[model samples]
Target: MKKIIFSSYLKLKSAPLAFMFALLFVAASCDTQDDVQPDSRALVSDNITAALKNNNWSAPGNSSAKERKPTFNTLLVALAKTGLTSTVAKEELTLFAPSDEAFAALGLYPNNIGNVPNLEQILLYHAVQGELYASDLSAGFVPTLNGAAVEVTLNGGVQVNGADVILADKRALNGVIHVIDEVLMPPTLNLVELALSFNPEFTILVAAVQKANLVNTLANDGPFTVFAPTNDAFVALLNELGFPNLDAVPDETLRDILLYHVVPGRIYSSDLSTGDVTAANEDTFYVNTSNLTITDANGREANLVPSLLNVQATNGVVHVIDRVILPELGN
Candidate 1:
């Protein structure tokens, strides 16, 4: 089994040059706002120090660190537009505040945030119930207020759902703020809905779930990691068994086969290693992300399709497998 061990984070002393300009700008003009570079990575680098201020947000009328920190002007406006400034002020919550440059990337501005289809859900996806400091941030899924968990990876850097956390551990009166490079979107669809959305590709898998009467199980109750087999894999399995179609397979056997592909959790590719992984059916398989292969209990191996990995859903994550490896079943 691959043991998930979260190590202590080593804070980088030298930050990028952009946020450094904030300290100099503090001396130059504390009252003036500098021209923000509207680039993707620049989103995190620009005005990060300013974002680290201990603002309770109770006082939004003045230019104070304890009031409205200038770096997060875009975020502040978004909160105000959503009427969530008071919520951040009183409720002890964590805000994964995206930079102004991040908003600019999506063509969003202080005046046009209403253009977003679901602004509140998008905004709530960035905030969690309690303070999640840099130290407290571990490698896994952390549930957001929008009812979806954002995946966190601390390997190369701290990334929340692929957005880099450029600045972390900034104090706030009500909670804390972690400046991210990009905005986070909570998944609107569950696993079944997501699979259905990708119509042709997941058609057979969807059909199999329906056949097994596990549609509701896959749809509603999960945080599951599904290593799904393609239709070609199912066809090959049928040919190997001398069966004409899915209808020829026994219901209990099909259920066991479907359950063999699923694991109970939102496991990402980073969370995998070269070791045994227990499936929902109590059968075990060996996964090696190094070479992208999974060896089933029956000794048959299938390669994990890298191009189709980590397709996120509201209830879980899905990774495509080339072959449908089976458990040891008596003929």
Candidate 2:
């Protein structure tokens, strides 16, 4: 099982950035590992039963759930838990509703929303101060309700923060809703915090980083580009290597593998070119821009899934890959 401490790794500090972007990043870097601060912003409920009771719950009056046909059941539940449902339902705002799969890709299960320290900030980040239709959106940063600016890319099928806008312009009496394929995370968290905050899906990776003692290197003074793999990817690697779990792998071997995923600068998906780039381990991987895939020395290829690209953390960026690329481990 994943450790609870891992989830709280990033909740150790707080800042009043209303949006918790760069401000949060500065605060986080100053925080010590032992100084875990309390976050008053988190919804004080862990499950629907607790949320319904604590949140002054009221059902949506207009059956927008039926008309929107509950297209965002997960999002609605999250709004309700944060007690922002009524505000969203009655106010004039634009909401970017993340699909269930979007949340999953980010390692956030719907049930765990309440446990997150920055729930309010995260939910607010998805909303704009006023209504914005697809036509109104331009390719640039737009202010969100959380007080941060999110990049809107009109180049390829309409992407917000590198996430494709799967469904657009779903009219709500209160506002317009755009369904996104990936969750948009604020730039408050560093790569380590981002991975540690979202667990189970990233437990293996997080554990590896911790075990390798690469946390401080990633957390401080870096705009490193990291190619993170999902827990499934790690599992497949363990099975292939004949290891039951990460612990069975040698520390040196694990550290090298972890380093292999990192590049020493901030390289966003948009900036990727077709060719070979050196990993932190000094190994090379072939990047094919045509399909956005990376091929390792062993000829194993991992596709950079569209739903998990260009996740910007405060100190660096994280790109999710479908497989763990192994370096040439010499005997």
lDDT of 1 at 295: 97
lDDT of 2 by residue, 67-183 (tens): 332235566678878998777766778888786667766666768766777788788888897779899988766767765557898876789889888767655545666778787
Write model 1 residue lDDT over 84-156, tens digit each, in one string.
7777667778889887778878888878886677788788888889878888988877878776678888977
Q: What is residue 329's positional error in candidate 2, in angstroms?
A: 0.5
Q: Lowest-lDDT window of 10 residues in candidate 2? A: 39-48
**Each model's number of backbone clashes?**
0, 0
Query: Model 2, residue 241: displacement in angstroms?
Result: 1.2
The true-versus-predicted C-alpha distance at residue 280 of model 1, in Å, is: 2.3
| Local lDDT at 104 for model 2 | 65
lDDT agreement with native, every candidate: 0.77, 0.75
